[model samples]
Target: MTVFILVGGVFTGADVWRETAARLAAAGREAHAVPLTAIDAGRPAVGHVDLETHIADVTAAIDAVGEGPGREIVLVGHDYGIHPALGAADRRPQRVDRVVYLDCGMPRDGVPPLAAVPDPALRARLAARAGRGETQGELAPPATHEEWQRWGSTAGVGVAALDRLTALAAPQPLGTLLQPLRLSEAVAAVPATGVLCTRNGVGIDLVQRLVDFGDPVAAALAGPRVTFFELPTGHWPMLSCPAELADVLLRAAAGAGHRLRPADTGTPPAHLRPFPLDVPEVPRDRKGHVDLYVPGEGGARPAVVFVHGGPVPAAARPTPRDWPTLVGYARLAAAEGVVGATLDHRLHDVADYERAAADVTAAVELVRADPRVDADRIALWFFSGGGLLAAPWLAEPPAWLRCLAASYPVLEPPPGWGLGDSRFRPVRAVAHAGALPVVLLRAGREAPGIAATVEAFVAAAKDSGARLELVDVPHGHHGFETLDPAEETGPPLRHAMRAVVTRLTG
Candidate 1:
């Protein structure tokens, strides 16, 4: 397929392209991460900062990549890297697949890298920081993540580079910034993908709004040459939410939908609340409230409460992109004679993965407060990322919740980061399992890191007094039931969910 020459910017490395590269490699494509600004960490950094030189470097890199047999190249720019990336793309539009911008869209020509074209918040953040001397400020010592600490200490690069940059860097020749490079020709010929990281609090809806604001510029792009995908995370998501960040980048490159949660848990267990016309929660989670399919024909069945996942506190939404078909879980539970009620947990401020394991405790409380649910037999069935949120409670969940189940769960720092498995390292969540039985499920051909995370969790939980079961299934992928049409179009695929529910409530 097409090749990608990634142009990383100042203050960031090529790390953002890691996951995308890996996925492309896996899919049999070529990708290269081109690093720049080797502008010395010490003084003389000013002399090294040259836009024209950087542009030449990109053109050179493309020529090198194309050496023997040339393939289409997409020169991607991130942050300030756009100045050079766009310039190179303009000089050699024939070789460029598309000049795709991440977070920062196409900046108008003649304006400095610091100029404002669209996205008011981004402009404001940059202006405030630059004004406060972030660019010209003295080089401060670097404090970085533990893993990177050693490398950073050795490299001795951090904030000081900014000071060096400001003191000696060239005043970007104004023409490049002010001139809107003619995209109508190349935009129509080349394919481009715009990855808007929602990590900045900009979701799909917000992305649409921003696009509407830039409609004039967009119309000039010419034809269906560009695409956009929102990664709901942060500005520096590669550092904060790397695994999720990687997933998003891969989705953009592959032209595929992000993974979704599974739906329809076969015949719901008997202990679920029947689909109630009157509804249960009545007010706060009106759109999200559902009946519990209680098991057995008894007056008071051990009711199961369902809690879905959001980044932190679960806000109930009428259009839950993942589990709309959770309705099937309830229908099955009702038929089985159990009460099944799904709820939204209480984490609102959390924006990253560290709180993933910790949020389970709060979810337990929300599920327990329910009147229809039986405190003794409550069970948790979570999917994909939900499993990360659910893992903490597996060891000794509340007295009410009796079982824990998760499918295609992410266990820790994830593979691309190679921080190893954190799922088994029970710190804050160790005390949670008051003796809840746990189940961890995985599709046979899962990505390497997830498999490792699950294995680590199994090993860690081995002697924790909690029962653990690993179910390796025949069909599915991450969030397969939710994202894959094969699973959603038919009834056979719901069998896996039924299998988990059967063990939990039957």
Candidate 2:
């Protein structure tokens, strides 16, 4: 039998993996814990890691084990470590009997792993501060309670040391973080299991049981050839509930031997092979993939594009909380006989929004290239953070746009708009204008200082003879609470969006 390799995740060290290895060793089973350089958030001395590097490290461990003894291996990935495990397993599927994901899952095709978390702005902010690298792709953790506190209390490490570590940390490749894991078809066929730590849901303030189960680790419960078990502990079960965690893993391992193959219940209609007909079909990047869901229309239709903001390569990474808003917005635009495209633009803290504006302009060119699209009739609709990326255009409207409808647009990047330094430095950055018709929406309860920025943009557009429709919105930071109707939220922002869309397009 080969050994089971445990891959350590964010802020987690060999010690975390060691705990599991110790348990496995005590059980008289072969196991090897592999730690690939992401622990020590305070000391990001190690170079940056995309899944590829992490994958290489784990694959080397398996090869080392295989060379030493001919033991069948079962791989384990905890937290961010799952990236490397999946990458490695994709290479050696048969040699490994199973791959166990312990609370760590990567985006499957288009979205980046870190980008999938709903409202992950907080985490992304921390990753940059913690020196995890620019892409926020690396994870080695204080995944457990003690670990989190330890990081907070580690004041002894000199600030100089911290700075040095941060300098050593590297940036994530543009697309890998959002590029979705590319796996051999064989890897998906492998029997895998997920062990979820419920501590996450508890801390999150409002995660339901089903939502927790839908997590990557929990996705196994619904995905084929995979099983899921949730534990009410922090993200790291090894430290929070090692004994129970071990037991769950052992049982899941036992269950893996019994493959479930039954008669088919039913077959899907041809139109629904993978998804619904309204799904927006967009073009792909180098990987030949696009995250936007554009409806398939046999004839030409007016086209509209969606450009998301993150200043990160995988800007289009899906947000769990925004599913309703995105789908609804897409549906609304599609119903208007228009093609919708949500673009994944390049991002960085030191990003030049003007460059992003140019990127959006190129995307518009692409949309215009297709005969299926009425290039001259395109409408630009965006709100909240996405509005920031397009704000630069208000002064210098993109040449191809039919018109621009923006809500709560932040004309300039606020002092701390997630980027360490301000990229939208007033004058030089935002110079888009010239008799363009535009609609501006602002949250009534927006941050005091932010309102000025919004006003400035509106003023600039007006100064340039652009038609500005100012609508006072009674809402919060992101306007997602409005898109998904069935969802219950405090106020109604959807009404605000509808009003803006109607004024801009109608």
Best lDDT among the predictions, by candidate number: 2
Candidate 1's residue-wise lDDT over 1-506, tens digit each?
56777775444445545655676667666778765544322222334344565666677877777533546676777656676777777777777756667655455555556452222333456567655645433222223333222111111223443343234333232222233333234434556666655423223332332222233444433234456666543344434444554555555555443221111335332113232221223212332333334444455555444544433223323322224445555444454455665644443322234454344445445445655455566667665445556645554455666666666665543222112334433322434565566666666655444555666666667655555666655554544444344433234334544554565566
Assess candidate 2 and give its lDDT.
0.51
- Misplaced by over 4 Å in model 1 are 1-6, 9-43, 47-97, 100-135, 138-146, 149-190, 193-298, 307-318, 321-324, 344-367, 415-434, 463-466, 480-506
Question: 332-408, model 2: which lDDT tens digit per residue?
Answer: 56654456555544443223455666666676677776676666666676654456666455545655565666655
Candidate 2 residues lying further than 4 Å off, grouped into runs, are: 38-49, 67-70, 116-119, 122-180, 202-224, 256-506
What does candidate 2 score on TM? 0.41
lDDT of each: 0.48, 0.51
Q: Please state the error at residue 465 of candidate 1 in Å.
A: 6.1
Where does the lowest 10-residue lDDT sum fall in candidate 2?
201-210
